[model samples]
Target: MPLSFFSGGGETGDLVRSYDWTSTSLGAAESWPQSLRTTVSTLLLSPVPIVLLWGEDGIMIYNDAYSVFAGGRHPRLLGSKVREGWPEVADFNDNVMRVGLAGGTLAYKDQELTLYRHGRPEQVWMNLDYSPVLDEEGEPAGVLCILAETTERVAAERRRAEAEAAVRESEGRFRALVNASSDVVYRMSPDWTEMRRLDGRGFLADTEEPSVLWIERYIFPEDRPRVRAAIDEAVGTRRAFELEHRVRRMDGSAGWTFSRAIPVLDGGGRVVEWFGAASDITERRNAEAALAELNATLEVRVAERTAELQRAEEALRQSQKLEAIGQLTGGVAHDFNNLLTVIKSSTDLLKRPDLAPERRERYVAAISDTVDRAARLTGQLLAFARRQALKPEVFAVCDSVRALFDMIGTLTGSRIRIMTRLPPAPCFVSADPSQFDTALVNMAVNARDAMDGEGELTISVGAVDQIPALRAHPAVPGAFVAVSIADTGSGIPRDRLEQIFEPFFTTKGVGQGTGLGLSQVIGFAKQSGGEVMVESEVGRGTTFTLYLPRVVDGVRPSDDSAHEPLMDGHGMCVLVVEDNPDVGTFAVQTLSDLGYRTVLAATAEEALTELATDAARFDVVFSDVVMPGMNGIDLAREIRRQHHDLPVLLASGYSHVLAQNGTCGFELLQKPYSVEQLSRLLRKVATWQRRARIMSQ
Candidate 1:
C-alpha cells in the first residue's frame, strides 16, 4: 500500500506516496484507517483535559494533552504495549483494552488515579472511556481510549461532605460547652434588642427578633444612657461593645451582670450579627463590697482597741509609779522622823537662855540646814510622782547640764570623774527649769550609786533627727533632744532593764537606793511624748538615755509668780475634819501652836455635829480627803450650807483621785504638811473671811 508515482502529472503536481500514521497513533500504521484520526483528535482537544490511546497489542501515541494526563511519560510511546508503557497499570490497561477489542464500551466517571512522575507525587482524577476500533469489514482492530481529569472537582465534593459531618459533631459539642459555661452565650442582631440567648435549648424563641422597646424595658434606668451610647457606637462603627449593669429579676431583686459583644462583619464590613456573653456576678460583687467594708471596720476597731489599751497601760504605769513613790517616801519619812527627833532635841537644848550664843547659833544653823535637806527629799518624791505642777519653758539642754555640773560634782561625792559631752549646736527641750535641773540631779545621784561613788560619770547632750529603736518601743518618732547619763560601773543585767521602769523594783540593796530615779525619767519622757532606754553590758557600764521631743516654735514658759507669801496664823479659829484620830490629834496640836483655835472632828458626821452646835464660830473648815461616809467635798458643802461665809481647805494624800472629779473653789493641800504650811493656809483662809465680811457690811 505504498504511494505510486504517476507519469500523467506535471512537474508541480508530482505524485507522492501516502505515509502510514497508524503505527504512531494506533500501534499499527497499516491497521489504522484514516477516518479514526479525525475522531480521536477532536475528542482529545476538548475543554476538559483529555487523552486518547489506540492500540493493537499495546498503547498507541496520543496528543500533547494525553501525555500531560499520563504525567511525564515519553511522547515516543507509539507502538508500545500499554503494559510496557506503564507497567504499574499493566493489568488495568490490559483489561481495559481487552473489553474495547471485544467490542464492549467501558466508561468510568470521576475515577481517582495516582501516578509518579520523575518520582514526585501526582494525583489525578479522570472520567475514563474505552471503545473498540472497527475495520471496514466490521471486525475488531484496536482499542480507543479517552481520559478527562476531574481531580479538583472530586476533591471539592469530598471536602464538602466532611465539612457537613464536622458541623453536625461540633453542634453537639458547642451546645454542651455553652451549657456548662458560667457565662450566658448569646447571638443578636446589630440593634441589640433581638437577642437570641443560647441555653440548653438552642436560643430563646421569643427573642428571635425583638423590638427596640424590649431592650429598653429590660435595661436598668440608670444604665440606659450608657448602654444606649455603647450600642449606638458599636453599630455605627461596626466595632465590639461591652457594658456592666444591674438587671432586675422577676422577683424584683436586682443583680449585676457584665456583658460583651463582638460584631460579625459581612464582606462589605457591615455588622450583620453580634455574639456576646453575660456573667451573673451579683454574689461575687456583693461579697467583695461587703468584705471591703468589713475590713475597713475591722481596721478602725483594731486602731481604737490599740489606743484604748495603750491608755490603760499608761494609767497602770502611773499608778505603779505613784505606789512606789509612796512606799519610798513613807520609809524615808520614818527614818527622817527619827533623825528629826534627835535634831529637835539637840536644838531644844541649844534654845536655853544659859547656852553660849555662838554654840546656839551653830546649832540653830544646823537645824535649819537639816530642815532644808528634808524639804529637798520631799520635793524629789513629788517630782518623781509627777504630782508637782511644772513650769515648762523651751530651754537649751546644754545650759541645764552645765549648771548641774557643779552640783553633780558635789553629789557624785568627789569619787567619780564627771565628764561632759555637749553638742556644738544648742539642743533645746521644753520643761520646767527647776524640775529639769532636779531631774538631772536625780540621774547624777543614780549614776553615783551605779558607780558606787568611784567610777566615771558622763553627761552628754545632743539633738537627733531619729532614734533607731524608738518606733520598736512603740514610741513617737520626731526630733528629740537626748540627755544621756552614763556610768562606768557594774551594769544592769538584761532581764532587769524593763523591770527597772516598774515601780519599787530596784537592783540596789535597801538604804542604798530609792529606785525612783529611772521611774521619774520614764514618766517625764512619756509625758513629753518621748521615751527612756538603757544600754548596758554585764561588766562595763550603763547609759540611761532620756529623750524629749523638740519643739520647733518653743513652748511659752509657765509663771509660778501667783504663789502667795507665807503668813503666821494668829487670829483664826479653824474646824478640822480628819477621819484618823492620830491625824486629827496631830493637826489639832499643830494648829493650836500656830495660834489658831482648832475644833476637831474624827468623821464627817462628827464634823456635822460640831457645825450644828455653832456654825458661826468657825472661820474655815479643813477636812480629810477620804472618809467612811460623805467625802471631804460633800462635808464642805454641808458646812457651807450652814455657814455660807466659811472658807474651806481640803487636805488629802489621794490628791489625784480628788482632782479627777473637777471639784474646784476649795483650797487643796497634800497631806503630811509642815506646821508652817498649816499656819500659812489658816491665815489665808482668815484673810479671805474678813474680806468677805467687809464686803457684806
Candidate 2:
C-alpha cells in the first residue's frame, strides 16, 4: 500500500501522500519499511515540531510544527536527506544524523544554525534535541529530532546585560563624587547602631575604632542623648532625620555640625539602613555668639547715657523752680508793702481828735478799703497756688459763659468788642462754676490789656473728644468741654509764653498788672480735673483754652438750697474739733455769734470723748479734717457708726489728711469762710437733724 493509506488525512498527512517520493532514495511509499511507515504517521500527527530521518539516507518526514520551522523549503525538503535539505548548516546536521544513527543522543540550548529556508541563507537560534529510533531487532535505525525557536528570548537577554553594565558604571561615578566632597557621607544599619563611612573622612573621623559606637565618640557629651533620640525616632518612623549640634573634631577641638539622614526601606516597607550627610558650622555659631555679646554691652552703655540725661533734666527743673520762687517773693512783698503803708497812714489820720467827721469817715473808709485790697491780693495768690478750696459741680459750660457775657463786656468796656459763640445745646463739665467764670473774666481782662483796651475778645464753647496737648495734664482721658477765649490783640511774645503761667511772671509795667491771672486759670483747671493751654503768636493774637472733663448729667446743680435764709442756731449745742488753739477759739466765737452753744475739743480723740459723754447734747459736730492722734475723717466715721443721727461737718485748710483720705462722706467746709457761709452750713445741718428727729418720733 501507498504511504497515503496509512496517513491521517490532515494538511500535513495529505502533503505527505500527494508528494511523489518514488524519485527519492526512499522510493515508493508502498515499498517503504513498516518501521519507517509507523514513524512517518506519528510525525505527521504531532502538534509539536517533530521530524524523522529513515535509513542511511536520512530522508525527512516532519509534522505541521516542523513544516512551519522549515519555512519555504518544507514539501521539497521533506523527502530529501538531512545533508541535502540544510546545505547552509550541512556539517551541523550531518553530525546530528551521524550521532543519532549510532544510537547516541544529542541536545543543544539556543544553538546557532544557518539554512536556505526561503531561498536565502538566514541565521537563527533554536533549542534542539536528537534521539535515535530503533528497529524491531533493537538496533539503531533512524534519527528523531525535536526543536523550538529561541531568537526573541536570546535578543532580550543581550539588551538586559548591556543595561546592567551602564548601571554599574554610574554607581562608580557617584561613589567617586561623594569621596571628593568636604561633607561627610555615611550609611548606618537599620537600627542606626552601626555606621560605615562611604567617604574617606566622616564627622566621627577622630575615632579610629571600627566598633558600632565609633560615631558616638565624636558627639559632644551634652548632645549625645539628643542625637541618639533622633536616630531612634528616624528608625521607628522610617522617616528622614535632621539636627544641628556640637561635635568633637578630629583635631580634638570643639565644633558645630548640621547633620541630616533618611532611611532606606526594604520590600516589606521595613527600615533596612540609613543614608546621611553632615556639614561643619562651627564658624557661623562662633560669630553669632560674638554678636550677642556686643549687643549686650551696647545696651548697658545706652542705659547709662539715658540715666545721665535724666539727672541733667531734673537739675534744670530745680533751677527753674527756684527762679519762680524768687520772683513770687519779690512781687508779694512789693504789693503788700503798699497796702500796709496805706492802712498805717489812714489809721494815724483817724487817731487825730481834730479831724472833721467827714474826713474821719473817709480815713476809716480808706483803711477798710486797704484791708479789702490786701485780702483780694491774698486770695489771688492762693488761687494761683492751687491752694484755694474749689466747690466743683456739674454745670453747663455754655450756660456759664453766656451768663458771664454782660459782665465780661463791662470789664472789657466799650472799646473792646465781646463776641460770644456758645453751643446750641449745653456742654456740661465737672468743675467749679465760680472758678470757671473767674478764669474766663481773667483771660478777657488780659486780652483787653494786650489790645490796649480795644480789640475783639471771642469766647467760644464746644465739646472736645480728645486734647493731645493736654495729654500730660492732670485731667483723665475722655470727652471734655473746652471753653476757649481768643483775643485779637498785640499778642504775647514767644519768649514769655511759657513764663506767663508762672506766678508773678508778668510782662506789664510796675503797678499795671499783678501777673496772677493766667496762673489762677491754670490752678483752677488742674484742681477741677482739667487742663489749661495757651497758644500765642507774636504778631497775631493769643488763645487760652480751658479743657474740663465733660459730665453726662447735663443739669446744673442749684445753689438755691444754700441760698435759703440763714436760721439762728437757737442755742443748739455744737461740738468743735480743732488742733490749733487760735482756729478753735475763732470757730467757737463764730458759732456763738450764730446763736449756737459750743463745746471745744483740741483733737479728734477729744471730740469723740465729748460726743461719747453726751451724744444727745450736741446737735452738730464740726471737726477739722487734720488733727493729731486721729484725723477728722476717721472721727466722722466713728461718730456715724456710734450716733447715726448726728451731723458731722468736716473743715480743712489744705490739710494733708483731706488730701490723703478724701472727705469720708462728710460735707467739707473750706477754712477762711465768712460768717454767712458758716451760718448757712450750720442752719442746713441743724434743719436736717430736726427733720430726722421728727421722722423718728
Candidate 3:
C-alpha cells in the first residue's frame, strides 16, 4: 500500500488513508494510477464541494466540503460507486459517468434532483460542472464534479412569485368588479324567484315591492325563457350572472340591456340575495345588428383577408390554445373513468359457484348498478350530439387505460407482453365511457388472437392535430386523443384491411370469433366524432388506433359520495307517483323490498287523490317530475299547499322544467338511480325532514 498522502482532505483525508479501498471496484489505493492520485490530492485540499468519480464504476472520492454536503453518508460513501452511493439519482449519475468516461464534459446550471441527505429524501438544486480526469497515458479514466447547492435560491424565487400572483389576482378581481358596474341597480332573492327591489331609472317599469312574477313582467315574451335560464344557472352555481337580452320597455316596445348580477353572500358565505345592475344597450345592439348584416354580405371579401391573417397566426394561436388549457370538468366526460373497478371486482367474485344467494345478489346488484349507471350518470357531460344509446363522458385517456391494465393482463394471458407508450401529461377525450372500455378490450383481445397467445402489445396515447386519409375514409383534422394498440403478430392482408371494420367480417375458422369487435370500435369512433384506423405488415405486426375527439377542459373532479352499504328504511310509507305503469310498479316493488310501505299512483292527479285519502299515513311523496298534465313540479306545489307538513321528493331523467326552475327548493333524485343511490337518498331526505320538523318545533 502507498504511504498516507491524503493530508490536506481534512477529516476526509484521514478517513481515505484508513479506508480499505481493496474491497471496492477501485481496488487497493497503492495500485491507483498516478493521475487519479494527483486528482485526489488536489481535491482533498479544496474548500469547494468537489468529488472524483473514478473508473467505469464511478468510485467516489470527495474532499471535506463534499463530505459535509453528503451529511450522514460521509465515510461510508468514500469508496462506493457514484450510482450505488446516490441510488435515488442513479440513472442521472449513470449518464454523467458515461459522458465523462467517454471524454465528454457536462455542465448544468441549477440542476434540480432529489437527494437523500440526513437519511431522508429532500429535493435539491445544484450547479454541477463535470469534466473528465485523464490518466498518465492521457486517456479519460473518471469524472470530476464541482457542485454548488442552489435549493434555497430556487425556494426564495418561488416565494417571490407567489406574492406577485396574489397582487395580480387582487388587481384582476378589482378590474372585473369595476367593468361589470352599470347605472340601474336591482336586488333579488337568492333563487331569483322574487324581485325584492329595482330602480329601472325610467328605462323600464320599476318594481318597488317584491313580485313573484318579475320575469314575466320585466322580460319580453321572446326573451323570458333565455332570461330565466341564465338567472337559474347563476343561482345554481352562486356565481356572477351576466346576460344581454331584450326586455319590455316602459313604452311597451322591446329594448336590450346588458344585465350583470353578483350574488350577495351573508357572513357565512351563503347567497342571501343577488345584487345586480343593468345598462341599456339598445342603441349599441341596433348598431351591432346593422354591422352584422353588412359583415354577412361581405363574407367572401373578408374571408380572404381573414384567411391570410390566420395563416400568419396559425402556429402562435395553436400553441397559445394548448397552453391556455391551464384555464378549465364535464361530469361523465365520455372521458368517463372510475366505473370499471366495481364491474371487474364484482364479476371476479361472481365466478365462485357456491356464494350464498343474498351475497350473490349483492354482487350481481353491484355489477348491474355499475352498468346501469354507465347509462344514467350524465353529471354535466356533453350529451351525444346525435341522440343515441351512448353515455358519452369526458375522461382522461391515459388514466382510463391505466385502470384497464390489470384486466388487460388477464385477457392477454401471461405469455404475452404488455407495454405502454403514454405521454406524461394526461390526454382527455369525449366518447361513450362504457364503450370506450369495450373498444380497448376488443382491440386487446384481437391482438392476443393475432399473436396466438404470445408476443407483445403496446398501447400508445397522444394528442394529434390531424388524421391522415385512413382506409377509404377522408382525412379528419381536429384535436384528437389517439390510442394506438400495436401487436407483434401475423398481420392482416392488404386487400382485407378495408373490410375489417365491417360487421360479421372475420377470418377465424368455424365459431372461434363473432367478428363484432372491430365493428364496435369503428361504430364507437364514428359516433364520438372520431375514427378508427388500421396499419398492418404481413408476418410483422398490426397496429389499431382508435382516435377520439380530444377535450381539454375536462369535467371538474368531484368527490364521489361514499357509497355506504344500502340501509334498510324504517316503515316510512312512500306515495310513488310515476306516469309510466312499468316505472310505478318497479318503484313500488323496490320500496317494498327495502322495508318501506309503498302506494302506487300512475298520474299526478291520481297521486293527489291518494294523498287526499290519508295524507297523514304517507310520510313522503316520491313523484316523477315530468308527466302529461299538472307535471311533477305543479303536483309538488299542490302537495305543499294542501299537506304543508308532508315531504315531497321529485325524480326525472330530463325535465326541461326542472332544468329551468331547478329543484324548486324541493328534494330531487335523478333517473336511472341504482338501489344504493335510491336507498341512500330516500333515507337521507326522510331523516332531514324529521330533523327539520324537530328544529321548527
Candidate 4:
C-alpha cells in the first residue's frame, strides 16, 4: 500500500510521515492499525487547529495550525502527555481525557482557561470540541480535539459593550442635566388672585387643578408677601412680573427661584390672564451670599482657591487622556473588519456550486491571503501587548546593530544622513534578536519620517552601569547596554510625548502611520527585561535610548550554521529527559520525526533508569536544564561519571543552577527551540559522542 494518507498538508504532514511511532504507545508507523493511522493522517492534513491524543496518556499529535495555537509550547508539546503538557489547566484536560476516552464527546464554547504558555499565566477563551477516536476493536482509544481561540473576539466584544454603555450613560446625563436646569410654566388670572394649573418640571410641587391659595402652597410665607407685592405692581402696570425669592420646592425644601409672569392684554385694552416661567436660583443665591462673606477675606482665600482650580484642571487632563482607549479599539476593529471583508466576500462567491474552476482557485487564493494577513495582524497585536512568546539567545548588541546598518540606511531615505557610533568592545545582551532588530527598524523608520526624508540620524551603542528612570519607574541599577537613536528633526511636542506609546495613537496624517511601531518597541524592551526612554526638545531634535540587561557570562550564540548539511536521524537511539511534560513530549516526538529512536523520561531518575537498562545503546542524552529532582547539570555530571563517553545536551529558558554554577562545560540549547534548532543541536552533539567513542576504541 502507498500509505498516501500521511503525505502533503505542509510541514506537519511531513512530520507525521517521518515520525517513528514505534517509540510511542501507538507502535511502529507502518503497523499502527488502520483506524489510528487514518486519524493521525487527518490530524496532519487539517487546515483547522486539530490534535489527536493517542492511548490512555492522551499523547498529543497536532497539526501546524495547532502549533500556532500552542503558543510557546508548540514543538515540545507534540508528544507529551496532555495533562503534563498544560499543568496550569491539568484538571480541565484531565476531565477532557476522561470523558473522551470513555467514548463520550464534549464541547465548550468560549471556555475560559488560564495557561502558563510563556512562563506567565494568561487568560484565554477557546471554543473546544473533543470526541473519541476508536480503535479497530471499536473501543475508545484516543481523543480527537478541535479548538478555536476566541480571546480577541471576547476582548473586542467587551470593549464594544463598555463603549455602548458609556454612550447610553452620556445620553442619560444630558437629559437629566436639561431637566435639572430648573424651569416651570404656569398661568394666572390678570388680577393675580387665582392660579391656573402649573407644571413644576422639578422646581416646585405641581398644581393639577387651578388653585386660589397658590402662593400659600407654592411659595414661602415670608417670600409670598414680597412676591405678592411684585405681582400686584406688575399686574397694575399690565406688564411682566419678575421677582427672585424663596419657594417651597418639590422636595419641600425652601429654595430660591426666579419667577416671572406676563399679562395678556386684549385688543380693547383690557388684561385677560397671566402666563409665566421660573428657574431655580438656589445655588446662585447661596453663591452670592458666600461671595460677600469671602470678599471680607478674599486675599487670604485666593491662593487656596487657585490651588484647587489647578488640581481640577489636572484631573480634567487625565480624563481626556483616557479617551484614547476608544481610538485603540476602533483601530483594531477597523483592521480586523478589512481582513474579514475579504474572507467573507471570497467565501460567499465560493458557495456557488457552478462557479468556474479558475475563479474558484482565485477566490480560495484570496481567502488564504486574507488569513495570512489576519495572522500577521494578530502577531503584531501580541507583540505590542504581552510579547510573552520570546526566544532569547545571547548576542552582542553592537554586532547586531552593525549588521542592521545597511537595512536601517535603506529604511531612512537616501537623502537622510545615517551614522553609527559603537564602543570598542561588543556589548552582549540575552534577548530575542529578531524582535530586537524589528524594534530598531521601527525606530529608524520613525526617524526617517520625523526628518521628512532629509536630516542626520545617529545610532550609538554603549555599556551602562545603570538606567536613569524612564517615566514613573524607579531608576534600575544593573549591567545594561544602551542603544540610542538620535535624530535632528522637528521634535515631538511635550503634550504628545506621553501618548506616542499608546496603541494606534499617531500624530501623522491619516494613511501615514499605523502607530504600532513604537508600541512594539516598548513591548519588546519591557518583555526583554529592559526599558525605553525618549527625550525630545521641540524644534531641536529627539533621542530614544533602549536599555537591555547585559548578559554577564556564558554568552554565546548557537552555531546553527555548522558545516554540516541537514541530516536524518538514521535510527540512532537517544535518551530524552524533561520534567516539563509538554516540552518533553514535543522533544521526543520531534526527534522521532527527524528519524531518531527516542526514549522519553520525565525526570532525571527515570532517565538514569533508562540509561542503566542499556547505557551504550543510547547515542546521545537530550534533557531539559530545569527539572524537579537532580537538575540537568547534575544528571549530565552523573552520566559523565558513569558513561564518560555519552554526550549530554541540555536546554532551558532560564535555570538558577545553570546561571550560578555555569553550563558545567556541557552544551546548552535555549527553550522554545524550533525543529531545525533541535535537529542541528542533536546532530552536532551526537557527532561529538560518536567521535569520543571512536577515540576510546
Q: Which candidate is the best by lDDT?
A: 4
lDDT for position 410 in model 4: 86
TM-score for candidate 1: 0.46
Per residue, candidate 1 scores C-alpha lDDT tens digits across 281-395 of 7888899899999999999999999999999999998998787667676657665886698688777888688998888888877777677666556555555565543435688
Query: For residues 1-697, what per-residue lDDT tens digits would candidate 2 score against the true structure?
Result: 3455465736777778877888788888888777778888787777889988877888888888888888898777778888887777888888887899999999999997777778787777899989998887888899999898897888778778888887888889878878777777778888777877777775544534344875567688898889889877877777899999888887788999998998887899887788988888888899989989998998999899989998998998788778656666667777988889988999888889899999998988888778766756665676788866666788888877778889889998999998888878888888777778778888888888888888898998888887655435443568898888899888887777777887667776555456788898988877777788888887689998988899876776567756666668889999999989999999999888878999999988888788778789999999887677888888889999999999988887666455444576678887656566788888778778889999999
**lDDT score, residue 583, model 1?**
92
lDDT against the true structure, each candidate: 0.71, 0.81, 0.81, 0.82
What lDDT is reached at residue 661 by model 3?
56
Ranking by TM-score: 2, 1, 4, 3
Clash count, one per candidate: 6, 0, 14, 3
| Number of clashes found in candidate 3 | 14
Which lDDT tens digits does candidate 4 get at residues 120-174? 8888899999999998899999999999999999988989999999999997885
What is the lDDT, from 0 to 100, of the residue 309 in candidate 4?
Answer: 90
- TM-score per prediction, in order, is 0.46, 0.60, 0.36, 0.37
Highest TM-score scorer: 2
